[model samples]
Target chain A: MSEARLNTPISPFPSREQKQEERAARRAAVLRAAVRMFNARGFHATSLEDVATSLGISKPTIYHYLGNKDQVLLECVTIGLQQLLEAGAAARAGPGTGADRLQSFLRRYAEINMDDFGRCVIRTGEEALTPESVRRFRDLKREIDTAMRELIEEGVADGSIAPVDPRLLAFALAGALNWPARWHDPAGPQSPGELADLLVATLATGFLPR
Target chain B: MSEARLNTPISPFPSREQKQEERAARRAAVLRAAVRMFNARGFHATSLEDVATSLGISKPTIYHYLGNKDQVLLECVTIGLQQLLEAGAAARAGPGTGADRLQSFLRRYAEINMDDFGRCVIRTGEEALTPESVRRFRDLKREIDTAMRELIEEGVADGSIAPVDPRLLAFALAGALNWPARWHDPAGPQSPGELADLLVATLATGFLPR
Candidate 1:
């Protein structure tokens, strides 16, 4: 929740120094390929060989960097969640009425087009992981959910948001944020920002709010 | 959406007598196994052999009954969707107003706690289907969406619901309906009818339309 802690580095923040940047890019490329195949074909359906082939890299390199296929997946999901949480935390920390903070955070998330819509490892799907891995992802997921819920509750208390069940509101907001992975098209009529705005307005203003 | 049209046997629904009833039971058993597997392990992660093994049948028997893996999946999804749509339709036919119909339909879906929790094939990790499968599913998907949206639109027009973009309302209603797949638990605090009522009330009342 603290500003400095919120912006703290997530696995070194995918560097900008040339050598490090190239390495980060390759790592990202691997993660990207993994997500496409994992999401489209499924994580179990995909193999280390498949990921290596897609990346034009040796399978050994992947093992060296991320340990195994599961680790690679965990990293990808964690990275994505960390990004959202960071944005959400920063937004909440901003100087504004609760609505402004909530909107600011959600808009950034909405702009995340559907192409990268991997299921968050912290959500229930992490049951796909090994027992040890499950503990970690579950902890992270609950933390994120709790933090996000607190932010919304704050907005409600400040009178920016109308009275709504915080829990249901969480689900609704999470549902909208999570839906893009299921339906977003890069070539679609509305851009991510436009879609996010529409969602924000709809949730904030009840369709038939008295 | 004619009753006769839906009643037409689609392979699994072979006969009208006890023979057909037997077939339907067999089909439901197979679908139950498939759902359990798909939920525990994702679709691409699951193998036909695994499902066959779970059913205590040989691979050949599964193939004989359902043709191939894709067809089995198609049937499983069809079964789940048909059950959901039929429940919605029945509510529509028995309701007081369009809003009432929508609320009843929503409540019916909330019955995830009764026993059908996470059994809805349309929600949760469905992206891995082959393109051909996606097409067939989309057709059915469209009909359900249109039917639900029409109900919402009617509610708005009748002053029973607030006037909002029917399209967005459709999406939000969808978000609400599909949410149970993620969180509903029969062993949890809420009953199926209670959860459904809460959801319908939340959605119907808007922020405060109640």
Candidate 2:
């Protein structure tokens, strides 16, 4: 190589930060591809080979990035659950009445369920996971459930929400929100935000007129 | 043979009705066993052999009664859908305000989801069934949706229910009720009937105070 070429700021090889960013971007791409296929075809029906094929990469590359299929699934659901946990924490920490915070959290919760990773969380059954993974999945899910119940309890305590069984109410709300993952068509006219708002409105006001 | 035996009115062979009844009973037993196993282990993880073993019958016996695994799942979901349809019909035909009838159907809808056949319907995904069976399953589910929508429409027209999108409301109500199939414990202290009532009440009143 010429001295002038060597002295130039631009290098043929990627810097360490560039390499790390590229790796993170590639990992996210694989996860996105895997999660979408899993949601569309189901975990049992989808093969890692197909996910790799969709990404124009080799199966070994997927393994290098995300481990095995089970691990890919765990990662997807973990990301989704973490989003929910963060939403709950944000809502709790934000200003307004208890009901206001809960409503904000529920909207985000519904919207997340309609997204790629969150849809995977709702669509995946425990039977799809290895025993160890299933335990971890359940624990993460239980934390979200606890977070929801606490929101309900806070709302009830403040008298902003109706007096109801927090557990039952949480289940009802979660089920209503989780269902969009099953039935929502991304190609449909209604956007996830609109659908989430409508669902939350129905839950807040109920079937009965005020 | 004794002359008294020849003269007896009773025959050694079963009557045709007796044979029919026995066959029906056996088929029901097989279905019951299969649905329970499917709900517990999930449709993909469960096998006909395991179901047969649980009932002390052979796999062929299961096939003889319910065709194949996909067919068995189809039959199970069909039964559950039929129950929901019947509930809708009965509720519609009964004398009361539309809200009253809707609430009645909702309770039955929730209770049925906690039962064996209904739980199977909720747990068994479309991917688990054959393409043909998936079509049929979806058609039956659509019928139930139609029934629910009509009930809601009637309630809205009669001013018994708040003015809302019947389709969205049905989805919300069905989702809330459908979820118990995933989380409900038959062995738990709360009965299906009680849980159903609680869920229906939650949906009816919603989270906001009355």
Candidate 3:
């Protein structure tokens, strides 16, 4: 034990918590770079080397940090969905009419889709993913869809929203919110927040039962 | 003179009009096959051979009819845009109110995007095209956007729509309508027409000045 202690340097390894935090931070940084490249050159066309070059890291480093291209994409999508789901939860918890909560949730949803990670999530299609990954992606997307529908139903029940088909309404709202990721210009005059506000307001103002 | 007459066949070949018709039909068939394949397995992953095999035609036949993959994609996008432009024209001509025209136009637009050709057009992005093709595609899409904005402005001016920013409203409407191409399932419960109607009603019912 004394020989082992003598051979080992003090603070040779980080604490477990510290290592976990560092790993997470590195993972996030790699994901950010990956998402950017994926958005610019579609998910299929983008290789790990492409991502590695952009971040000034080696291809194996990306694989080391994130398992593979699929895992990288899945991670980005999970982060994006988690953010939207959290926003939905917050909106539900906030004090407001159902309509107000729905609107706020939608606005955040739209803004997120145009953000760094979210844009990648929206742009990456099932064709790029493995069968299992596709299933997971679809399930998560469906969860979001169900949440939107339920929010709309709540609004209708409470007399804040019009009596519309919740499923169809959810589709329309989600479609509009998800679309900005495809065409939104980050350098354009409209910031993500401004564009999100404009879209959500249009839906809210036009959708209310008069 | 007798020898010349004997040498010439009784019915030498098809007339110019007949030949043109045949060529056009074959071209249409090739395009149809290409669009279907592109929609099924995105544009980049799809090859001329895949389209040809699906149609039981040869790759040379696809090239003979459509020139190349880039040409195939450009043609599909052109057809999609033309259909939308035609719908806009029809809406403009068949009028109860400006809002009525806009709603009708939007419904048709959504349905077109869900159709085989239009779905391919939506799924094909700029990354897959040459710079010139991308420019042309963007120009046509911009034309559609402008038409939508004008329709909304007319509705607002005529007191059929609420006083909203027409450009923003147009984007919201177009985003909602264009998105169905990405996720719409033909095997699903909702028919394209039914889905379009529900979406249009949601927007129109909510947007009218109260």
DockQ of each: 0.24, 0.83, 0.45
lDDT of 2 at B138: 92
User: lDDT of each structure?
Assistant: 0.68, 0.92, 0.85
Clashing pairs in 3: A206-B206
| C-alpha TM-score for every candidate | 0.78, 0.97, 0.90
Docking quality category of candidate 2 according to DockQ thresholds: high
Candidate with best TM-score: 2
Q: Write the per-residue lDDT of candidate 2 for residues A113-153, one digit (tens) a residue.
A: 99999999998889999999999999989989998899889
True contacts kept of each: 0.21, 0.73, 0.49
Please, what are the lDDT tens digits per residue for candidate 1 over residues B116-159? 32354644355456778878778877777777788888888888
> In every candidate, how many clashes are there?
0, 0, 1
Model 3: residues with Cα > 4 Å off, grouped in runs: A1-13, A207-210, B1-12, B207-210
Interface RMSD of 3: 3.6
**Runs in model 2 with CA error above 4 Å?**
A1-4, B2-4
Model 1 residue B3 lDDT score: 92
How would you encode candidate 1's per-residue C-alpha lDDT over A1-210 as one tens digit per residue?
Answer: 799887877654554686687877777888887777776666666798988988788999988767798788788777766777777778878988777877787777656524363343323264467778767766766666676677778877988766767776666566656666566666788787777787666666555436
Predicted candidate 2 versus true structure: per-residue lDDT over B1-210, tens digit per residue = 999999999998999999999999999999998899888888888999999999988999988888988888899999998998899899889888888999999999999999998998888888888998889899989988998999999999999999999999999988888989999999999999999999998899889999
